[model samples]
Target chain A: MTTTGSLANGEADGTAGSAAPDKRGHRVTISDLARQLQISKASVSYALNGRAGVSDETRQRVLDLAEELGFHPNSAAVALSASRTRTIGIVIARDPTLISTEAFYMRTLVGIEQYLNEVDSSLLLRLTGENGEDLDVLRRWSRQGRVDGFVLFDEHQNDPRIPLLKELGVPCVVVSSNAPDDGVGRLISQPEETVTLLLDHLAELGHRDIAHVSGPFHFIHEQLRVQLLREHAAARGITVRHIEGNYRYDDGADHTRRLLTGPDRPTAVVLGNDLMAVAALRVTAELGIDVPGEVSILAWDDSPLCELAGPGITAVDQQTMERGRAAADLLLRLAGGQQQLHLEAPPGLLRIRTSSGPVI
Target chain B: MTTTGSLANGEADGTAGSAAPDKRGHRVTISDLARQLQISKASVSYALNGRAGVSDETRQRVLDLAEELGFHPNSAAVALSASRTRTIGIVIARDPTLISTEAFYMRTLVGIEQYLNEVDSSLLLRLTGENGEDLDVLRRWSRQGRVDGFVLFDEHQNDPRIPLLKELGVPCVVVSSNAPDDGVGRLISQPEETVTLLLDHLAELGHRDIAHVSGPFHFIHEQLRVQLLREHAAARGITVRHIEGNYRYDDGADHTRRLLTGPDRPTAVVLGNDLMAVAALRVTAELGIDVPGEVSILAWDDSPLCELAGPGITAVDQQTMERGRAAADLLLRLAGGQQQLHLEAPPGLLRIRTSSGPVI
Candidate 1:
């Protein structure tokens, strides 16, 4: 019953045999291998270290035994079966430009690095487009012994990569997941109840017609938000509309233009992210629509970009940095062989700004 | 003599009787190893592949020969000694938060990935503070056979890491380099003389007191820009000032406030980047100083944030993304064992918008 917490702390004591897995447990050791081989521990070390002092005859036997017994001399110098490369992988399955300024990865990466640096691990970052290309890359990497684990981001519900990761026997911690049972630990913002807070706030502002301009529809949270908005609109007996966008500036501008200019336009519009929200502002101004006067805009992710705009956008503060660090903490636990990880993140808070107001 | 380009293209012909070192050179191959050991190519392949059919005696001998001859089994599978992990490393030695909103890394990374993906290579990203922690991590990674090469960003004059990189024999492509024959390629904006263009533009605008707010001062381009501005200002018989500031929002806002509100405030200010320039605009607005009316502001790195600001930030477009791709192409060539690489980037284009105007 050695806990992951104890194991992480015991990292410093590995050299002095402080990492014994209790006296009775059958964890193999260097001395045990030497005793079984009838060779000196020094000779075993030389063979394992790829040193030339060991005879060719001895080195082959050592490698075979080590391989059979599942042992590798990792940085921590623990005699374990796990071939720990001490590298973490994160794949971006989108045009990186679309989400580069989100501050999600920045905060999350810092948190991941803070823990990994303490444990002395490196990050392997790959940015590629979706359509299962990332899975193929991960498969190749696993076979080639590239990374020890992954910190998955932007994973959607029923993501196909879950099955592939399980199949490959790769360990990972996914952030903001919405799966039935993917066997992946998730670090996410709190309950789905908060979606109503936004709708209710807008509804209270005397809005009859509402619209939601969204990020990529493939993401579960984005889909969930869209569905919830529709449900709330139906429940409140208010007219609502949904427009799909790619989370790019063009996507937001084009969608905002079409929605705001259309005859049946909503008084208030909610954008998927701050970047799009900013873009929406430009579009609104271009269309001669006044903020909080004619067209009210609400943005997701309370990034600085939202506040810095002409009319500070109303947004949901997701606590990006805290969540990022939390992701790393859970990932470390999962990597340490914890079966279940369900970290509850700081819930989203509705920051009412000048962007949203009573319907004109 | 066979070139690296031909070898890269000949990746499909690895197993055949192809990949022979042509004409007047000695490039060892699997055939050479087989001939030296008086064994068949099948035995060599089996031994090198770590298959069960090859006896332990034969495998050990093959490994010894392979190591001695500097041969590695890379992904593309030509029988030369480059221990191709097919992983490229890039170290971000700055505060990622300050510059995350800029699309520079996003664009550059895409370019880097486009080429590396073509050759089936991955990117290992390490973000660290400016205290040279990245080099230490890279040294460990190099010893661990982690990455085959690097794509270094923002390299400066007399950088301590240059000697270390050379010492470690790691292949790299440095952007904005100012070293004397560091044996690395550079992907810089074309027209190396754009600094004078900015100064000349400003000087002609009747601005006697000019100032520069920049990114990290340790970076070569920033230093070079500061120097060139001073030289140009001296030539034009105008006064110029240099104040160091991290390219962060707070830094921009705080520095601009102090400079503009000071006893001898400059009529015009040039910032290190768009984020700062945007911050400067807010500060000016808050301090009741009209931009381009009371104090003209010019920013570097013509990012979207610049154009989207209250007053579109006048900037010099360095074509960051294209330069990043060029860096990757040059790095690939250098990794192919080319002796020298000097790729000039497209020069910066001075784009004047609403931010900067004549001194009133």
Candidate 2:
């Protein structure tokens, strides 16, 4: 651990007064306490931080002096020597414009922030540029000891960050089902159950043919959902077709239009997210199609937009906030030097609304 | 300015080798470089940081040694003595659940993050609990030198944070017109012009009576908008009534129902936000009232939600992302010790859609 030599040596030699302010008249620092107590700064730090190596009498003296002097540990100085910043880093790589419209990320951030607040830690948020600067950021932060741990999101298949984080030996928790269990913490959700619930709802509505407008298949969860949807549909004797979407409103609308206008229109359509479902609803209105009568529509994620849409969209309640809280809990445990944790979030629930019904 | 005397003095006396690792075999630190160069760590820091005290020759030598040794400055160490963290703080003292649904804040965050990324800075985000911990956070962050500056949002009438920030002497930029300009930076939006434009559009549609469902009056912007709306309505020879709304869908719907079901129903309704406008649309539909045919509905802010709504509600485009970028720019300037800045964002544009039409 590197520290400023001149300040500590000069002060230790010259000062014995209790709570003597630095030359600049700044707040009392650990060095000030160390100088007054005529002991090494390391011992003072160890005592204040409740670390081993300091005698009980010395620790008590340090605490008593700290209280009397009104000493607030400098966060930066503590971070440098103690190697803990009390800050967690989250780096998001996505189009800045799209991030604003994503209700999922927003809710997840709230959950993460709520837990961090309770723990008295700060969140260091970074949005990576287009050139995949996320990896670079992780390396720099790790080398600089800028953050104690990281919470990773939007996990891709065989995510490159996993290997990099492992090499750095940084405590990390990934909110993904696909991440390899290589000692890093994992927060997994039951996509299989989610897909089955949606399919069951559609089958019960007597829909034999369905089109799934899914998020980019590059995402692990999307791939899992698609695979599960086909397996479940086959069991129910229902035919299903998959269309790729980027989880945006325009693509959802465009895909819906193409499907409804093509040679074979599915009796029911399931969209990847609430925004896409709202877009599909608009397209159906534009095409003069009667929802739930001529066709049925469902959304994979539930949000206020789905509930507020003209013909309220039937959706799967993913319990996004709860998932966020669970991820945070697992991350904090991992960061606190606990064993690598694996938490499975509860499966989604089907919310039936006006947009889905018996196929006429 | 406190440093570890033993590590530096011991290393400076013993080390003359080129790029010698510390005893722990950890990454190279500024102390390592200083020891190799046989100089004080402060000189090395000043040279590497390109500060004024270092000579040209020394600065070049420091730069060359840093490059050859692959030395990345420790952010925490630099923060301690140099007093610059390259991190900006933002504290939001609102309910976590409401934060997730608000698109305005989401867009603003994107804008702020975009600018910070370009400037190679991180955002330190904090959400205060119900006890108004925001002021405490600001004070602690300032005292700890955790952030170089702060970007404040959701300005309230006579906000207590203003005085606290000033007393702390921390660089700050407030994103509000109502903030008292006492040397802190300000990013003001033209609420008066925005109100005039919306009022003109409604007047052109022959709507003589208008009901304004505004955000909580405690917020300065909402107060300004309500005041402006009334002033502009009177000039346009229109009668206006104000209803308090919490900027949530539920309150917006309830307020709309009360206004529409009342005996003296206004021909036009102006909502505080896009979500509220969507709720008002739903309420009008539930009451069997035709939008634009009986009562015109307009939103104060335009988002994708507004465009996706049935009949596409008219709204005022507030340039939310741009406002966020501007606030970030101003905050960065203030943190850099530039002159205090006060920038006026362009007036919101009136976006006319099918929801506003001639009153029958």
Candidate 3:
């Protein structure tokens, strides 16, 4: 069950147990294989450990040689000295009761787990409360060399943990797109760019004024997109009104009711996420606002709920899986000793469904 | 940040070191504490590890003794003998790409993580794919001692992993309410029980016939509830019709188009989950069927989505957070060296929201 690496320059030739072959099996070593193949011990060990130094041709030759000699490395001995554990550590905020409501966090975790499983690594998750208890536990665990590395989620700018994690020399890749760097590696979505594209698309559709319903202000990504929305609107000379939401459908509904019925109501609306957008659709329907003809709506982050919503929701597709997979790959490299550097991918997709149309 | 433990013997009357410490600096050790408290090494180690041999009064005294002496056990050394890695491995079916769709999985994971954090333990996650690749990976992980125990989800009757897990000698708690006993622990929730109660309530209102739309047959809970629906109807001598669904809104819409528009439309309907139930409400509305007057509908496994679907869906409430927390607590006990046993808790709630009413 354990990944193995061959030993260098060690051999008790098969002849040692040849006399009692039926009971006491012969021990095949890397040296025995090297000798049989007329190759060096270094080449045999390199091939078995999956190290990159050996050429593909030489690697195959070494592998074939080992198979012919019936060699199997001692898994325990390899484990004791291997540089990597192929395991990642995750720390979460306390309040086990929050698991059901926080759907986004759960999705991200599942994505990370999927990526790790593909690479044959395991995840270690630690829960900490808001008061920094989890951080304390993680600090102790990291110093003891209990795990190879970590994947950081729920990152706040200038997080108290960053300094300590840096001191421990633990490699990490952050899930947050806007978390400030303190020399640690990170992976996050492109919120600022995504918002700009969304605003521009809505403006091009002959809409003069637009309303925005956004997520909680404390989150860095939420704040980044909010700031960008204001800047983009100003540059385009479009009037924009922003409302705060908790990234839930009800918040979207309540805000929609207030805005749609108000004097000088905007012709279109943009929501922070699909859940909120779906709420907007319902509230609009209740108020007798014909979508696109009277008021158009666009949502960020296209989830399956968008398609299932009655008329289908026009939304931003944030490439959640790519975001997750890229994070996993980056974390793996960092754990394998790749130094920290900024890595950026293309912007997420804009999935245009029936929710948004030209302003009449 | 390390969790400190006390020394065994009474304090030693020795002068403190006012000199240079080791390379990491700050020499905090059981040896130093034993000298300060004049205690035996065995006594200090016992108190530090939270072992049971010492009396409660004596344990408190030793703890205070260590605190006063400023003793901290070495983290690496302590980890060697502990039964719990302070880590739980979670196995799931979906890859990270499908994270957004698997909302229940995410919520439950968060709940588990939240509770484990309170106890200062960590969670290790592994996604076994829908096709059994995850099973192979999980088996290898369990065998290699990569995790202390497991939290299993999406139980099917006589699941293939059950036998493999049993042989691995790893303690596990299944999330399914109808989890079969194959020598593992169970956490059961009977969502179908709500159907019987709802049907009886509707029957009392003079409803002579009902229709049921259920999830896939492979799901044990869905199967049990659908079976119970047929049984309950037969016993009451009431006409009932059952249809299969993929747990999707479209499935509900498609089935609604088939049954509701036909001549055999019943006076009432019961859905497998809230997602499909909401769709049924929309479809029935489009077909001009009068709800509660001409037709009454009931749903299962209520969530926030129920409330957003115009008229709130009357659903059987499965306390998601409580169920998750209980499973976590049981896992922690197993990690703490408790003998294994099968456990079940009742699916004890039926939320009678507006989606169901007396038949006219």
Candidate 4:
């Protein structure tokens, strides 16, 4: 309550309190920290901001020196500089209702928040209706100097936001499997390796034919996944059939219904996400088809739902949270003036559960 | 490229660009809009901020007039006033991993974002390890004038943050079932009514004995829920047994296993959340018990998992997103200097799915 007095008096902890200039009659700055540590200013900034490039020991030394020097960032002065707000922006261009149900974005947000919190930075979250609205929001925040940088999500082919972000000259990192090689930093997943992992698991189970229920083809990841699946399955001497899904439960149920009831149903079915896989399982149960006995099922993304389902669905764990944290780290480094930051997200792991088994 | 020039000069759209002073020589302000519209300044502010307690017609009129007058809020001027940062803070004192797995927080966030986005405001999200860290964050944000207000979550009995918030003098709204009536705005659910609804549904199915798998008892809502459940069940000639859970999948499975194997197993078990409910369904399957035939199951909170489960769990829809939106609206109003705002969240609806049936 009314902590202004304590904050202004520089309480003993040396945690972000206002203080008078040091013995040299000058406020300690990042440059001073760099000079004292004999490292570049960028390194000192990275260490202080808890960025990825700095080693733990270097970060500890930087922290110790800053504390001894009574160095604390003056946010008001920073704001006046029009350089850094110590805040990052993330705009999700999707229906709020849809976003509420999906666990992917939420997990990503947790990762981003965890990193920013550790660095004593803040996140500015915005949800928009369309790509155009997203640009508008970004422009407004940039013009207002409300954020130091942004973390981009849901990259599309020739994403319009890419050009806009470049034009705005704002630092950003795009988290997607299909991010363009434009100057911006990108955190991408290995689509070919992911596809190979899924295919190898199914092929070893003696499944010669498989059907894939993919997410909407407009998404770069979905397109890459379908293409890679076909390429990988062919090399494994297995036949692959493709069906487009919108990553919804009904899409999975409807496609599975058509596949199971039609001529020559594939022995194994792979879906784009956990929801669809669960939906496919429900469809199997409704039709009295034994899962993994009649048809093996696999989900693209692993979540609690996969394990909770009866005869737990086999899934590829994408490490969504880690990807989020890495993306945030890249964005922070980019904001710190580092260039060409590209990070390959950790590979997806095939979680073998009861849903995938030897073909009967 | 650089938007500084355009942002410094008023454009045709009259949207947030800097503009010259009007004919009166002084810059157009909210007072002018209020005088023109013949409404209180607070009403005009509410309309502009898209907060509750303002009619749609009035909001439209305020927007139309503001556009005509080229009245765009200058964020720089606002920030300098130390009154409105146009940013709301939400500190979720929970494990990041746990936050990612639970759909509840995500849905609430979506709701909060929707409201804040409509008002051209931003959400500052922070995830802390514990209550003490949460307090530190609030104090820091408050001291720095980084946030205009906060939205409190997960209230506990004899909550410590209440006094601190009051002393900080920062406006906030607590979204909880057991928020204290200490002058702060509260968006609370009807716990008694919720308990009665759940009991009535189970009793109607001829279930005389039931077990309640509840969230952590330390939560004020959980305490109120269990107490209300027993009081309501006694009048309905039902016996209620309580099992403490941490709102995890394992809690539901472990409790259900214990109950099913022990003597005088309840005819029905009500879980605290969807994850727990799904876990219980798995337990019944492992034990070779027929759902709704040997024992009935129900869940407290409804989510996609409830419907995806094999039998489709019977659940109480808490309208979490609506609650979140309401809390945001209340907080915005409080930040605008309104006081004593209290709202009752919509009552939970009992969604009777395939999992519940008459006692066998």
TM-score of each predicted structure versus truth: 0.75, 0.78, 0.72, 0.79
lDDT of each: 0.68, 0.76, 0.64, 0.76
lDDT of 2 by residue, B116-157 (tens): 664456899988644466886898789888998888887887
lDDT of 4 by residue, A1-360 (tens): 001121222233342223345786565655567678886554666676555667999999988988888775443222213337778999988877778877888988987776565555678998865425677778878877888888988777787877887898888888766646678877776777777878888888999999999887878888888888877888999998988887788889999999998999999999988888998998899898999999999999898888778889999888777777667656765676645457666567889999999997
lDDT of 1: 0.68
Superposed Cα deviation of residue B216, candidate 3 (Å): 3.6
- Scoring each candidate complex against the real one, what DockQ results? 0.20, 0.33, 0.29, 0.37
- What does candidate 3's lDDT look like per residue over A1-360, in tens digits? 101111110112221111111123444544455567765444555576676557999889876755555554333113312546667777765344444553455555656665555345667776554555556666767876767767776566666667788888887777656535557776645667777777778878877798888877766677777787888788887888878787766788999898899988898888887778888999888888998789988887687667656667888877655566556556665665545433443367788888788887
Candidates in order: C-alpha RMSD to true structure:
13.0, 15.7, 14.0, 12.3
Candidate 1 or 2, higher lDDT? 2
Candidate 1 lDDT at B58 equals 94
Span of ten consecutive residues with least summed lDDT in model 4 chain B: B1-10
Model 4 lDDT on a 0 to 1 scale: 0.76
Query: iRMS for model 4?
Result: 5.7
Top DockQ prediction, candidate number: 4
By TM-score, who's the top model here? 4
Q: Which stretches of candidate 4 lie over 4 Å from their true place?
A: A1-83, B1-83
Candidate 3's docking class is acceptable
How well is each residue in B63-179 modelled by candidate 1, as lDDT tens digits?
788667655544223321243666777877765554355556666676566445434457787765454567767676667667776778877667666677778887777886554
